[model samples]
Each structure stands twice: as C-alpha cells, then as structure tokens.
Target chain A: MTWHVVTGGAGFIGANLVRRLVQTGGRVVVVDDLSLGRREHLAGLADTLLLQLDAADAGALAAALRMVPDGPVEVWHLCANSDIQKGVTDPSVDLRATFLTTFAVLEVMRTRNWRRLHFASTSAVYGDHGTTAIHELTPTLPVSNYGAMKLASEAIIRAACETFLDSARVFRFPNVVGLPATHGAILDFTRRLIADPQRLAVLGNGMQQKAYLHVAELVDAMLFIRDHADGPHRIYNIGPEDAGIRISAIAEMVRSRVAPAAAIAYGTEARGWVGDVPRFRYDVSRLKALGWAPRLGSAQAVARAVDEIAQQEFCRYDA
Target chain B: MTWHVVTGGAGFIGANLVRRLVQTGGRVVVVDDLSLGRREHLAGLADTLLLQLDAADAGALAAALRMVPDGPVEVWHLCANSDIQKGVTDPSVDLRATFLTTFAVLEVMRTRNWRRLHFASTSAVYGDHGTTAIHELTPTLPVSNYGAMKLASEAIIRAACETFLDSARVFRFPNVVGLPATHGAILDFTRRLIADPQRLAVLGNGMQQKAYLHVAELVDAMLFIRDHADGPHRIYNIGPEDAGIRISAIAEMVRSRVAPAAAIAYGTEARGWVGDVPRFRYDVSRLKALGWAPRLGSAQAVARAVDEIAQQEFCRYDA
Candidate 1:
C-alpha cells in the first residue's frame, strides 16, 4: 500500500489534505512540530502516524520516514512558517520553517530515492505584481521573506527534479481559506470579534484584494494535478479566476456573521503589514487547462470560511 | 573615508575587486574563511583588514563589521561555494555558502544600516536554458544545486531590497577567468597537465559551450554598475554578447599553453559535471545599455585565462 506523507499534516490546509487522503484509504504519516497544528485535528483518522518534530530537521524527518513500511511514498510538503508578519520581524523564521523544511524534505527524498513530491508554494512568490495577471511563468520577485523562502524552495525542488527526483509539482497558492484555521485574515477577524464584538479593527485600508481558494478546493486541485500533471517538474498557480474580494468585503462577511452591530475600523496604511503585497491577480489557466476549476469564487470562499470559522470559534463560548 | 566590505576578498574575483577598491583609496575589510580563498591572493593591498571567518555566521559577520570604523559602507558579497560539483555532492555546501551567506549579509546590513550591496550572482541561476539568449528578465529555473542556491540568494536579496535595503545591484556573472584563479576549466586543465602532461582528461563531451568573462572585466563591470545603477534593486547579466566558446576549444587553448604535446581525451556526457549547465547563451544587452562591455570575447577570455593560469601554475618549474 502507498503511504502519503504530509508535512504540517495536522495544520489547517495540511489537516484538510490529510482528512481527504485518509478517506482514500492510504496509510498516512503526518510530520508536524505541532506548534500550530493540533493533535485533535486528525482525531478520528485511522492508519495515521503523527510524528511531532520540526520538519526542517533532516535526521528527525529521515527517522520518521524509516518507521513507515517500504512502499510507494508520496510527500505533501505543506509545512512552512504560516505567519508572513513574523518572518518580516525575524527573517530566520521563514528561512528555517519554509526554506529549510523544503531542503530537508528534498534531501531525505534524494537519499531514500523517493520521487513524487507535492509542494505547497504561495502567490507571494510573485511579489507585488500590481494588477498584472500573474501566471506560472511570471517573474518571481518576492517582496516578503515568506515568499523569498518559498521561491528558494521551488528553485531547489526544480533542481532536484532536473537531477534525481522522478517528478515534482509546485502549486503556487493564493490566499487559502477554510477549516481548522491556524492563522489568516478570516481566523484573525473571527478571533478579534470574539474578543471584542463591538469593533472589528481591520489591518490596512481594507481595500487590499487578492484571490482566495477554499482548502477543500485546494486539496482537490492538488490531487487532480498530481493525478494529471505529467512532467519532471510542473508549476501551477491554483486560485479562483476572479481578481478577488477586498478586505473590507471580507471584514463585512466576518462582522455580519460574528457581530452584526460591530463597527468596522480600518488602518490608514494600504498594506496590512510589512512585506505584505496588498493586491494581486492570479492567472491559473495552467491548472484550468487540466480541467480543474474551483467550485467557489473568492467571495464565496471567504463567505463560507467566515461562517465555518465563526461557528468554530463561537462554539467555545457556548461550551 | 568610505569603506568597501568584500566578503570573499581573499578569493580570486574578490581579490581583484579589492585591488581596484584599494587603488581608488578606499579602506577595505576582507572577510573570508580561507577554505578555498587564499591570503596570498590579497597580498600587499593597502588599508585592508582581513577577518578570517565563515561568511554565513551572522553574529561573526556582525562583529566583524563592528570592528571596521564607521563610514559610508558598501558591501560586495562575493563569497560562495565555487565548486558546483561539491554542492551537487552535498547540497548543504551551497545552502550555507551561498544562500545563508546572503541572508546573513542582508540581516547584518539591515542591523548596521549599510544600504549599498553589490552581489556576485551567477549565470548558473539561469540554469539549463539551452541556446536561449538569457536576459536579466529571463525566468530563472536553475538545474543545479549551485544555481539553485544562487537563485535562492537572489530571491532573498530582492526581498531585502524591497523591505529595508536602500539599493542593491545583482550581477549575474558568466564563467569568470583570469589571474589568481581558484577553480574553473582553465585552472583544472592547467593543474592536470602539470601533473601528467601526456593526456588531458576532460569531464564532458567537448561540444559544451558557454560565455566566459575575465576577472578584470568582471570587476570593471561591477564598479561600473555601482556607479551607474539606480533604484531599490537592479539585476544585470554580465558577460560577452557572443554565445560562447566550446569546451573543446577551451581544452585546446589550455593544452597549447600548458602542454602542447598533450592529447585530449573527452568524456561522453555533454555536461562537465552533474550540476553543469554545459551550454548557455547570455544576452548582455542590459549591461551594454549601461555602457559597459567585457574587454574579451568568450574565446579570448578563455585563451587569456589559460595563459595566465598556466604561467601562475608553471612558475615553480622556472624557479
């Protein structure tokens, strides 16, 4: 039987991916530090082994892999420093969490002769391309340390594929939303409303806009790309076709669901934080070419995510 | 007085750059680990201080910068794992030497408020583009670990510039040749012929071709770019406008200068090594537009380098 190895597997998107993978009846090995990923996320999942360790530690990752029975192994490299703001504050965070994790995973794969790899990259790699539609071929001039490390990881992965790896797929994700939310605007807004339901203090001017994809749709596209992508190395920008919903719109969605009377206040700065690309447009034609499309648009995804997160966070109060 | 900080000042190109900086009457701080760089390379340079330490150590680098007297500082980051094959053997070599060094330098610069940085990037970052004339805007997809790390460094440097840096100039150098050669085809051929003058063993099939630039010309272009370039970040492909000279031709040039009687034996593989790009075309229009050009073509650079290296290596016989 094939083993699906998901780094950061118990985290938000990783957890969603793990849940899907488990349903497919494949034995899964989850490697996560659990800094943000909770053990409860994968509570009912069977045939799953949770290895709590830093994914960037090669020896630890290698040791974890050794415990798995020898078979066809595929790695879903979803582990990374999810907080872009933290990375801006300390560049080493992304260097270790994002870049080093990818390097360690690739090295381990090279040593063990494991081939298939699905990498979770980010749209930030394109940096601030303004309104220009960013495709897979867009020049990656990252503005943030988070994007820089992701681009670095992509470069190394490409090199590995060129030399030793059988194949690798790099999925450049836009803002991914939905379930088991660790950190993001949706989660942050929801938490803030829960703490102080009278006012929703939004970062930036609330005009910042970018594509969004639900975690379920993201997982589906990933699995679709893996099944369909036929190349040594492939890059796909996975996001909705629309330009995206604004932060103000997302703020309204969260505010209405969490606290209808909450006054929305926005920061004067156009960007939320340092190294934040306020706006971007993703041209995911390559992924669309493979006959895969998101069921929900950016607004729909945001709306659905807000509902999911509000319920999840509010449930704690009811308990 | 303005100070020039060269991270790899004891190495080949760094030494040459240091000499030029010294001639301009600026104080120079030479930071090198001396693993591959030699102290003798920067011999007799005036107003220069040598700090022997790995460039990747952020604390050490920060401490070294503190020792230098306060002044207008410019960093020429040239230190990296020069041996592509070594990096292919062990990826961490380039990770620490190339990528981490850039990160460390950027962090130190950010802390010290040192704004200006002239980075020594590589054609390797362009990877195996085949015969496509690579421009500064070329989508970089590096095929080797050396290239991967360089590309990674470039990404981080770009991010730094976007965030805290005043300005940065990234010079993507081709095969740099000429005096005090540490490693390359010319140096390798010269040493091999000196050991066994009967037969010259080549790594790859003789047809592999790529642009070459003399260290003198490379240094000249770097200074030229520093004086001319503006904005937060700039990248220039520094090389001859011509496609390049073949490796077979380089072999012949080396053999003629080092050992005229030596028979050349070629390996079947087109690439010189595992990570070798083998062939590439550089469109140096970007550098040329700035009114800078190499004094030597690919063949001329190779020939001149062969003569210089041969003389340097063969001087012991005359003594």
Candidate 2:
C-alpha cells in the first residue's frame, strides 16, 4: 500500500486530483490552508484519510507529513495563488502567497526527503510568447508579478529536483478551467451574464486566444507523467491543440447558458488586463510524445467549462 | 531646501548616496536596519543626518519619516541584499530582506504620497545575457533567486512609478566598486590575503566579467538623472564605457597589493558557483548620453579599490 500526499488538495485542481487519486485506491492525505481551499470542497472525500494542513506554514506541513501512515509517500505539490489579473491590482499578495509560500513548502518537503513529487505549474510563466506554440524550452519572461512568482516557483522546484528530490515533473497548466472555481475568465463571464441577463461585459477583445484544458484531462496528464517518466527531471507544458480559445465564444456560451438574449460588450483592449495574456498557444508535443493526448481541444474544453460553471451556479439557485 | 529621505541609508550604495547628498547641502534623513550595513560605513560624512531604522519595519519607517521636518521628502531607495553571490548560498535571507523589504518601503512611501523616488537596482536582473551589451530594454529573465527577487523589486518599482508615484528614477547598477569605508570584493580579497598571506582561493576560473563603476560615478549619474529626467518614470543602466572588468585581472590586482608569494586557486568551475554569471557586458550609452562617465575603467577601478582596501586594512592592523 502507498500513501499519496497532495498539498492544496482542497483547491480546484487539487480536489479534482484527489477525486482521480481516490479511484486509484491509494491512501491519500490532503494539505490545504482552508483559507481559499474549503472543507466542503473535499466534503465526502474526507474520512480520516485527509490531512488539512497549511502549505505555507512549514511547521504544520512537517507535522502533517509526520502523521502520514507507514507507506511509500508520493507527494503532489500544487499549492499557489493562481490569479494573474488580480496580481496587477496587488502583487504583494501574489509574491508572498505564491513565491514565499511555495518556498516554504519546498524547504519542508526537502527536509522530509520526499523523493517523488509532481508540481502543478501554470502557462502564465511563458507570458506572451508571440502566438507561437510554446514548449518546455521556451524562454520564459513573465510580464506580470503572478507569472514571475510562478516562474520563481518553477525554478525552485527544478533546482530542488536536481539537487534534493530525484523525481520531479513540472506541469505548466494551460488554463485549467472547470466548474465552481471561485475565479476564472469563464466563471467571471458566467457571473456577469447571470447578473445582467441582457448585456455581457467582456475584458479584452475576443481575439485574445489561449489553450484551455478541463480538470480531468489535466489530472490525467499529471498522473501519466508521475507514473511514467524516468531519468532527469521533466518540464511539460500541459495544453491541448486547436491551441487557442476565443473569449467571444466563452462569452456566447455563458450568455446562452444563463441569459439567451445577452449582448456581448468588449472593453476594446486587445488583452484582458495588464497582467492577462492576450494569447498563449503551447507546443505540448512533448507530452503527446509521452503517450498522453487531450480528449478535448481548447474550444471544446472552454465550452464544457462554461456549461459546468453555469450548472454549478444554477445549483446555487436551487439551494 | 530639499530633503533627501535615503532608505537603507546605512548600506553600501545608500551610504554613497547619503555622502553625495550631504556634500550638496541637501537636508538628509536616512533609514537603515544595519543588517549588512554598518554605522562606521557612514561615519565622518559631516552634512546629512542619519536614523537607525529598518525600512521593512513599517512602524519604524513611519516614525523615522515623521522625524523628517526639513521639507517635502525625496526618497533614494537603495537598501537591499547587495551581494548576488550570497543569493545562491542563502536565498531565503535575500528573498525576505531584499524583495519583501523593498516592497514594504515602497508601500510606506506610497501611503505618504512621496513625490520623487530613486531606486537603486542591480544589473543582476539581466541574469546571464551571454556577454552581450545588455540595455535597459533587454528582456530580464534572471537565473538566480537573488536576480529574480531584484527583478521583482524592479517590476514593483516600475509599477509604482507609472501607476502610484508621479516622478521616479530607477538605476540598474553594474558592480559599483570604490574606495568605500566598508566591505566589498576588494576588501574581502585584501583581508583573505592578509589572513593567509600564502594562498588565495578565488571562486570561479576567474573568467567572470562584469562592468565596474566607482561608486562616486554611480552617485553622479543618479544626481544627473534626477536633475534632468521629467516624466512618469525613467530607468538607466549605469556602467563603464568598455563595459566590464575581468575577474582574473581583479585577482592579480588583489595579489599584487598583498605579498607576491600568494598563489591563487580557482573553484574549478567555469562559473563561480550555481548562480554565478561567467560573462556579462553592459550598454550604458543612455547614461553616457546624459553627460556623465566613469573616471576609471574596470581594471583601473579594481586597482584603486585594491589600494584603498589595503590602506584601510593596514590601519585596522595598526589599531
């Protein structure tokens, strides 16, 4: 029997990862601050197996790790502040919560000698890559504080893997959009549509494209990399082809799902905000070469995410 | 009469700036934690006033700033973890003390509505630019955690200037070597030679190259930029004309200053250590256009620094 440790497990992607890990029949322990990560997010899944500990607090994380039952521990490090647009408004929160907090988790894990680790990184680290298909080797120069912090975390993880932990796979997620997440462009649009019901307000021009992946596909790729890769540490840009999604389409989907007659209005800027990427198309052929193909392209994934997000909101109406 | 509020006033660059301010007959108020800064570093500079206060400690900084009753305050923000090499060995220290500390100071200034700010930045933000003449426009993708933190600080400064503060100047300094009262490469080498007097262990193959400017020239550039530039914000890379100094040459200069029999040893790597940049050059033509230049080239600066360091060390021995 093996025990899997997942930090930020009660987070959007973390909870989804937990659901997948549950199916695999491994003893699972989740560590979350319960600040952004909710108890209800991991509701039925918690049955003495879940360990709710703050990832940013090293003392709590160390104590939590010690509490792990006698088994082979495979850790998944996925905790961070995942909002880029908000970073422009207040970058201090992003740097402290993301960079400082990530450093804390890395140091703690290194002390515990957690050999196997999978890091859930973000595509924002690449910034605006000139609409080319960005790969793992792409020179990352982040334009925003959030992206900078994520890039810092990626570098720290890579260094830790090279020096301390031998097994580390860094996955740069391309817009992991799905249901009930507190924040996302899709959720943001859906909420606006539900409120206005007649006029849909959109940030940036609709031409701003990006690769969006469903939560399941993201977790699948993560698991595949964890189970498969050997030799030196791996850096994978996890994205699907059809490579970019149009914001207009997401708006339309949300409008139709919530308010059928809503008119979409653009802010006239080419990009969403100062920190938001206008377009990001990843060259994820590396992951495809590793025997994993996404079930949905960017458009399909965004559509699915829109429906899921709307349904979750509608569930609130029923409540 | 204009008052200069020099943050990190006890640090190397800050002390140099304070000296210049004092000489120019400007009212000066300095704030420093004296972490790496020394009281002796700013001794006998007869003009300006000094306050022992941590820039990051909000209550301390606020109380110190309140003590400035001379005129409207002008900020020269120079405090930081100055050594890039130390960043690799001690990242956590630099990360908190440099980046986070800088942010706190900026926040305090912002709250005070301080008009003019001069940020003392480093060229390390450019990372390994591969011997190219890096300009202010060069894309900053730092390799070391220290560089990343500095880059982060620069980003915040830029934002504060553009969005928060009205007038600000950012100085991206190269290795500003000088006959300072306190510690530096020259001082370190002299002390090491005096201690052993037989064998000198220099880090790297000693091929690392970087632009060097006497600290006075750097301060002069800052004064020039402050007097001329009129806009939301301006940034200039301050370096020498030939662009840089060779590390091997600096070693020989230090050896020449010491007993000649001392053999030099390399760390046996192309780089000094993990985060060391083996080759660096700068394009400081912008500051040159602003009508200020370095009085000494890299080797000359090193020789002068070596002599000053030797004299200082000899005095200490006599004491």
Candidate 3:
C-alpha cells in the first residue's frame, strides 16, 4: 500500500481531496499546522493519520513521514497562506507558510529519496494579465506576495524535480470553492448576511471576475493528472473552461440564497484588496489535452458552492 | 546627494560596481556579511560606508539603512550564495543568502519608502536552455538551488515593484570575469595551476560553453540600464553578443597564462558540477535595444579575465 501525504490536508480543498484518497483505500497522512486548517474537517476520516504540525518545520515533517508505513509516497503539497490580504500586510506570512513549506517538503523528499510530489500552485502567479488567457507558458509576474511565494515554490520544485525527484506535477489552481468553505467570496458573503440580514457590503466595485472550480472536480483532475502526466516535471492550469463569474454575480447569488431581502453595497475600487488581481482567464488547454477538465463551469461552480456553504454554515438552507 | 546601497559590495562584481559609483560621485553604502566577500576589496575607498552584516537580516539591514544620511536611495542587491556547488550541497545557502536577502531588502525599501532597486539576477535563472538564445521572455525553469532562489528573488522583486517600489531593474548576468576575482572558472583554474604548477585539473568534459562578460562592461551596462530604463520594472540580459567560450578554450587560456608547461586534464561529466549548466546562449537584444552593449566578446572577456586573474593571483603576468 502506498502512503499518500497531504500537507494542509485538514483545510478546504485538502479535506475534500483527503476524502477521495481515503475512498480509494490509500493510507493517508495529513500535515497541517491547524492555524488555518480545522481538525474537524477531517473528523470522520478514521483511517487517515493527522499530524497537527507546521509543514515548514522539516524536523516535524520528517518525524511525521517516519511514522507512516514504508512504501511509495505521493505528496500533495497544498499547504499555503491562502489569505492574500494577510500576505500583503505581512510578506513573511507567505514566505514562511507557502514558500518554506514547499522547501521543507522538497528537502525531506531529497534526503529520503522519496520522489512523487503534486503541488498546489495558484493562478495568481500569472498576476494581473488582464484578459489575456493564461496558459502554462504565461510569463509569471506575480502582483501579490502570496502569488510571489507560490511562484517561488514552483521554481524550487522545478529545480528539485530536474535534479533529484522522479517526477513532480504543479497545478496552478483557479479560485476553488465547495463544501466546508473556510474563506472565500461565497463564505464571506454568507457570514455577512447571517450577521446583518438587512445589509450585504461587498468589496471592490463587484466587477472583479475569476474562474472557479468546485473542490470535488478539482480533486478528480489532480488525480487524473497524477496518473497520466509522464514527465520529470510538469505544470498545468486547472480551471473551468468559462471566462469566469463577476464578483457582483457571486454576491447576489449568496445574498439571494441566504437572505433575499438584504440590500447590497459595493466599494468603488476596482480590486478587492491591495494585492488582488481583478480579472484573469485560465487557458487550461494543457490539462484538457490530458483528457481531463472540471465538471462545472465558473458560474455553476460558484452557484453550487454558495448553496453548500450556506448549508455547512447554517445546517439548513432557507432557499 | 542620492544614497546608493550595494549589498555584497566587497565581492567581485559588487566591488567593481562600487568603484564606478564612487567615480560618479554617488554616496555609497555597502552591506556584506564578509563570509565570501573580502573587506580589503573596498580598501582605499574612504568615502564608502561598509556594514559588515548579513543582508538577509531585515533588522540589521533596516538599521544600516537608518545610519545613512536621509535621501533618495538606490539598493543594488548583489548579495547571494555565489557557490553553486555549496548551494547544491546545502539548499539553505541559496534560500537564505539569495532569496531572503532580496526579501529583506524589499521589505526595508517598502518600510523606508526608498524605492529605486537594481537586482543582480543570473542567467542561471534560465537553467539549462541548451543552445537556445535566452532572451528576457524565455521561460525560467531553473535547475539549481542557486538559480531557483535567484528566480524566486526576481519574482518577489517583481511583485514588490508592482505594489510598492517606484522602480526596479533586474539584470540577468552571464559569467562575469575580472580583477579581484572571488570565484569562477578562470579563478579556479588560476588557483589550481598556482597550487600545482604542473597539471591543471578541469571540471566537466571541458566542452561546457557559456557567455563571459568582463566586470567593467557589466558595471557599465548596469548603470546604463538604471539611467535609461523608464518603467516601474525592467529586466535586461547583460552579456556579450557572441555565442560563448568553451571550457576547453578557457582552460587553455588560463594554462597558457599561468602554467605554460601545465597539462590540462578534463572530467568526464559534461557540466562542471551537479547544478552547472554546461552551455547557454544569451540573447542580449533587450539590452542592445536600450542602446547598450558589452564592449568585449566572450573570448575577449575570458582572455582579459585570464590575464587579470593571473595578475591578481601572482602580482605579475608571465604570458
């Protein structure tokens, strides 16, 4: 039996991916600091070993790996400082959480001679490319510290794969959304409407648009690419084919689902925050060429995520 | 007067750049850890302030910046782990020295509101692109920790420029050779020949080819780009127009100059070391378009560097 190590595995996408891995009968080990990842997310998964430790600490990570049974290990390195605004406020947040975590993991892999690694990169690495469709070949000029660190991690991983690793896959994620949503537009809107049912204050002009992929579909594509990709190192953009949904549409969807009577107000700024990229288009043709694509489009993914978040937060959906 | 802060200013390229900055009458401050950078490199330069501290230490760097007189500042971030083999042996060497130094400098710049920056990037960021003439737009897939960290630094700088910096110029350097040499093929050859004086042992198959640029010309292009570049961020590959010089030819050049009777023996590997890129072609069209070019070709640069290294090493030229 192969050991599947998932960093940040107690978080949103990680938890979802963990469920899939468990269902596939893989012995899974989760490395999470629990700073952002909730242990309850993996509550029902009795077979998975949860190592509540910082992934950036190589010593802790090495100890965790030692606890696992000896076998071929595949690491799903999804660990990162997901909050872009926090990274903008404190660059070290991303530097340590995102970039250092990858570094530590790669170092461990090198020392142990363990090979396979699947990394969660971000579309933010493309920066504000405007409307230009970002393919795998897009010039990565990140605008945010979070994006910068993620790009840095990718570069390091690329180097490791070229030098030591047997193979590594880097998936540049679009905005991921689904059940057990920790933080994002849908969750933010849902919580706001829950607190003040009469008012919904949205960030930016609500014109910011971005592609979204449901967590389940994202997991499917990750596994598909893992089994199919046949190179020492590869990078693929994983996202829906649609252009994206505007922030305004997402706000309305959440408000309508949670509280239809809420009055929505928006900030005049074009972007949501200091490091926000208002718009981008992901040309996931590379992933598509491997005969894999997300099951839901951006709008449909957002719609499903809104309902899922409402149900997860409130235990029931009024709509 | 404008304050010019050069990290690693006591090293080869940095020392040369400091000499030029002093000649131009700029108030210069140098930050070096003195680990690889020799303090004597800046001897007799009475006007320059030297801060013997690690550039990766943000607090130390910030304190050093405060010591300088209040004025507009230009940070020439040249500090890095120059030894590729050492970085390959210990990844943290590059991570802390190369990547963190840039991060610390940018952070200090952001906090102090001092914007101008000139980063010493490397052609290693391009990795082993084979014979492809690497332009600024070429995909950067670095294969060495040194190269990876440099790429990471570039990404962080790019983000900083997009967010906080007034302007930044990233110059991708080819193999630089000149007087006051710290490390490189020519210096290695000279030192080895000096020690043995009979047989010269060459790393790699001696077929490894790469562009060489004299420190004088590199300093010239750096200042030229700083003065002429108009954008918030710009990247230029600084190298000679010719293809490059082979390792065998360089070995011959050094052998002929240092030990005329020495027999050269080459390693079987194509690359000098694990992280070494055996060959690369730098497309200097970007810098050329800016109306700047290196005065010496690769062969000429190697020849000049050979004589300079011999003089610096032996205090006289035998050739």
Interface RMSD to the true structure, each candidate? 1.0, 4.6, 1.2
lDDT tens readout by residue for model 3, A1-319: 6789999999999999999999988888999998888998999896898999999999888987887666578989998999999998889999999999999999888877788999999998888889889998778889899999999999888888667888989999999999878999899899989989999998899999999999989999999998899979999999999899999999999989999999999999999998899997899998999999877999999999999898888974443
**Candidate 1 local lDDT, A1-319, one digit each (tens):** 6788899998999999998888888889999999989999999999898999998999989987898766568999999999999998899999999999999999988888789999999999889988899998788899999999999999999888866788899999989999888899999999998889899888899999989999999999999999999978899999999999999999999989988889999999999988899998999888989999998999999999999999899886789
Residue-level error in angstroms, candidate 1, position A249:
0.7
lDDT of 1 by residue, B1-319 (tens): 7898899999999999999999989899999999989999888888998999998999999987898766569999999999888888889999999889999999999888888899999998877888889998788889888899998998988888767788889999999999898888889888999999999999989999989998899999999999998888999999998999999999898888878999999999988877788888999988888899887899888888888888898885678
Instruction: Evaluate model 2 with DockQ and give the value.
Output: 0.15
Between candidates 1 and 3, which one is better according to TM-score?
Answer: 1
> What docking class should model 1 receive?
medium
Error of 2 at B179 (Å): 2.3
Give the higher-lDDT candidate: 2 or 3. Answer: 3
Q: Kindly list the per-residue Cα lDDT of model 2 for residues A224-264, writing each as its tens digit.
A: 98888776567888889766778887888788788999888
The residue pairs in collision within model 3 are: none
Q: Please report how far candidate 3 places residue B267 from its true position, in Å.
A: 2.0
Model 2 alpha-carbon miss at residue A34, Å:
2.7
lDDT on C-alpha atoms for all candidate structures: 0.91, 0.76, 0.90
Candidate 1 residue runs with Cα over 4 Å from true position: none
